[model samples]
Target: MYHVVIGVDDDVEHALACVQGVTNLPGDAAEKEVTLVHSFTDNPSGASATQIHSVREASEYLEDHGIDYDVNESSGDPAEVIIDFAEEEDADLIVTAGRKRSPAGKALFGSVTQSVILNTDRPVMVTGTARGSE
Candidate 1:
C-alpha cells in the first residue's frame, strides 16, 4: 500500500483541495492510504478544531471512495511537524495545500510548504489556489 501524508491547517478550503487532488490522482486508488495531518504551535483547542475539521472533510471524501486513512495532530512548527509525522509514518508521498504569497511576504514570513519541499527526500504534491486566485 502507498502511504500518503496530507498536511492541513486552518484553511479548510485549501485542505479540502489537497485531499481532492490526491483522491483524483491517476493510479490505483484502492492501493493507497491517506493520513491527514495538522499542526499548531499552541492552543490545543484551536489545534483540535482545525485538525478535526480538516480530517472530517477528508474522511468524507475518503470514505466515499473506500480509502483507508487516519488523522494526526501535533504541537510545533507546521512544516517540521508535518515532515516529522511523514517520516515516522514512512510516507511515500507528502501532499500539501499552497497559499498565494508574494515573494516579499514569503521571504518575510517563510513558507511551510516551501520548507517541507526543500527538507523532505520524499516526493511532495502541492495543490490549491489558482495562479490568479489571490
Candidate 2:
C-alpha cells in the first residue's frame, strides 16, 4: 500500500497527466490510499479562486477513477507546504509536474519541484510535459 502524493498547480492538463501516469503504474491502481495536494502562497495581492477549484477538480478526477484520496490545501511557500504535507502523510512517493524554466526564472522564482527533490528523503516522481505544451 504505497502512499502516492500528487502536487497540483495551475496547469490542469499537466496535473491530469501526472495523475494518469501514477495511477497507471503497476500496483498503484490497487492501492487504497492516495493524496492530492495543492499549495498557494499567501500573497496580499490575493490568489485565484480558480486555483482552489482546480484542486477540487483534480480530486474529482481521482474519484471518477474509483480511487480514494484525501484533498489538501495550504497557504505558504509551495515547496515548504509540499514537503511538510508529504512528511505528515508519510508518503511513499511524491509526484508533480516538471516544467523547464529559464535560468533567470529558476534563480528568481525557485522551483518547488526542485526544492522538494532536495529537501525530501522520500522518493519523488516528476512528470515532464513537452515545451510549450501547456
Candidate 3:
C-alpha cells in the first residue's frame, strides 16, 4: 500500500479537490491510503470550525469510496509541520492547495506550498484554488 499525505486548511473545497485528485491519479485507488493533515497557524483550544468542516468533508468522501484514511493536526509552521508529518509517515506523495494569491502577495508573504515543494524530496501535488475563492 502507498501512503499519501494531504495538507488541508480552512479551504474545504480546495482540500477536498486535492483528495479527489489523488484517486484520479494513474494507479489503483485501492492501493493508496490517505492522511488528511491540518497545520494550525494559531494554536486553538479545540478543533476549529474550518478544520472540522474540512475533515468532515474529506472523511465522508473517503468513506463513500471505501478508502482508508485518518486526520492529523499540528501547530506551528505550516510547511514544516506538513513536511515532517509526511516524512514520519513515510508517505509516497504530498498534496497541498495552491491558494489564489497574486504574485506580489506570494512574494511578500511567502508560500507554504512553495516551501514544502522546495524542501521535500517526495513529489507534491498542489491543487489550485476553486473558481470562486479570493
- Candidate 3 stretches greater than 4 Å from native: 48-51, 129-134
- Top-lDDT candidate index: 3
Candidates' C-alpha lDDT:
0.81, 0.76, 0.83
Report the Cα lDDT for residue 70, model 1: 80
Stretches of candidate 1 off by over 4 Å are 44-51, 130-134
**Candidate 3 accuracy as lDDT:** 0.83
lDDT of 3 by residue, 47-104 (tens): 6534478778877777777778888888889899999999998999999988877999
As a TM-score, model 2 comes out at 0.82
Model 1: clashing residue pairs?
A: none
> Judged by TM-score, which candidate is best?
3
Residue 88 Cα positional deviation in candidate 3, in Å, after optimal superposition: 1.2
Candidate ordering by TM-score (highest first): 3, 1, 2
Report the lDDT of model 2 for residue 18: 69
Models 1 onward score TM values of: 0.87, 0.82, 0.88
lDDT for 46 (candidate 1):
57
Tens digit per residue, CA lDDT, model 2, 66-106: 77887777777878888899899898889888888999999
